[model samples]
Target: MKLRLGAGGTLRYGAGGTTDLDLPGDLTGQVVTVDLRHVDPGSDAGATALLSELIARGAARLVISGTDTASARALLASAQHDAPPSGLAA
Candidate 1:
C-alpha cells in the first residue's frame, strides 16, 4: 500500500490505481483517497474489511477518489450517511 501526507492533514492512499489499506484509529478524521473504480474485486472485499475494522477500532471518516473530484465528493457525502460497505447485520 502507498501512503502520502496530504494538505489539511489528509492521508492520500492511492491515485492511479486501487489498493487495500489497513488504516488505524490514529488516522481517524484523516482522508483516505483511492480510485474506487479501479479497485479489484478480490481486493475490494479486503479493503472493505479493513475499513470496517478501522471503524470498529474507532475511525471516523474516509475520502475516496475517482476520475471526477465532484463525483467523489458526492459519493463520500452519501457514504457518510450510510454504513461501511461490509459486515452489516443481515
Candidate 2:
C-alpha cells in the first residue's frame, strides 16, 4: 500500500500491505481515505486492526471506499460489531 499526501492535506491509502498502509505521519486534523478496492481483509482481526489503527491516529474521518459496495458493507459491519478504537466512545 501507499500513502499519498493530497493537496488539501488529506491522506490517501492505496492498495497494498500493512507496511504500505502504516500511518505515514501523525494524522492530527487530516482526513484519511483508504482505497479498499483490492483490500482483502480476510478475518475479523484483520478488519478490526485496520480500522482501529487508522482510528487511533486521530484523523477527522477515515473513509474506506472501493468499487465493491458489498465488501464495503461487510467491512463496516465487522467494525461496528467489534471493539471501538481507543479514543472513541463506545
Candidate 3:
C-alpha cells in the first residue's frame, strides 16, 4: 500500500499488483484514495474484503489503470457516481 498525501490532509492509498493484500485495521473508517491499477481483484478474498473496507471508510475514490479487468471495472463502476467530479477513471 502506497499513500499520497494531498491538500487538506487527504490520504490517498495506491494498491498496485495486489496478489496478496493485508489491510491494517487502523485504516478502517478513514477516507482514502484507492488506486488498484494492474491488480486482478476477482475472487481474491483479501482484495474484495479490502475494497469493501475502503468503501466503508467513507466514500473512498477508486482508480484503476491498464486494460480494465471485469473485477477491476466493477470496482470502478461501484464508484462511478463519484468519478466525474473526483476524476477517477479506469
Candidate 4:
C-alpha cells in the first residue's frame, strides 16, 4: 500500500494504484506522523514534497517511521533547508 498526502491535507492510501481512503484535516501546528515502511525505495521526491508541504503549512514536527529512518531524516533536513520562509513565528 502507498500513502499519499494531498494538497488539501487529505491522506490517500491504497494499493495497486487505487485510492481506497482519504482522511482530511488541517495540519497546521500539528505533529504529523508518516509511515513509509511499505513505500518503494528511490521514491524520495514524494517524501521530500510531503515534508516541504508540511513545513510550509506550519507543522510543528514530524515523526517518520520506515525501514530507512536515516534517509527519511536526511530528506526532512533537506526539505527544511530548502523551505521558504514563513510568516509564522518559530
**Which number leads on lDDT?**
4
Residue pair clashes in candidate 2: 1-16, 1-17
The list of candidate 1 runs beyond 4 A from truth reads 1-20, 40-63, 83-90
Query: Model 3, poorest ten-residue lDDT window?
Result: 81-90
lDDT, candidate 1, 2-90, per-residue tens: 34333232334554323434565454444444445544433334334444444444444555543366754554444434435333322
Better of 3 and 4 by lDDT: 4
Where is the poorest 10-residue window by lDDT in model 2? Answer: 1-10
Worst 10 residues of 4 by lDDT: 16-25
lDDT of 4: 0.65
* Predicted candidate 4 versus true structure: per-residue lDDT over 1-90, tens digit per residue: 245544343455554324645433345667777666655667666777777767776778887776476797798898898766665666
lDDT (CA) for every model shown?
Answer: 0.43, 0.52, 0.43, 0.65
Better of 1 and 3 by TM-score: 1
lDDT, candidate 2, 1-90, per-residue tens? 334333323345554423323464456566666554443445334544555555565555656665367765676566655635556433
For model 3, how does the per-residue alpha-carbon lDDT over 1-90 read when each residue is reduced to its tens digit?
454323332334554332433556444334554444334434334344445555544444544433347766765455443323322222
Q: Model 2, 77: alpha-carbon shift in Å? A: 5.1
Off by over 4 Å in 2: 1-21, 41-45, 67-74, 80-90
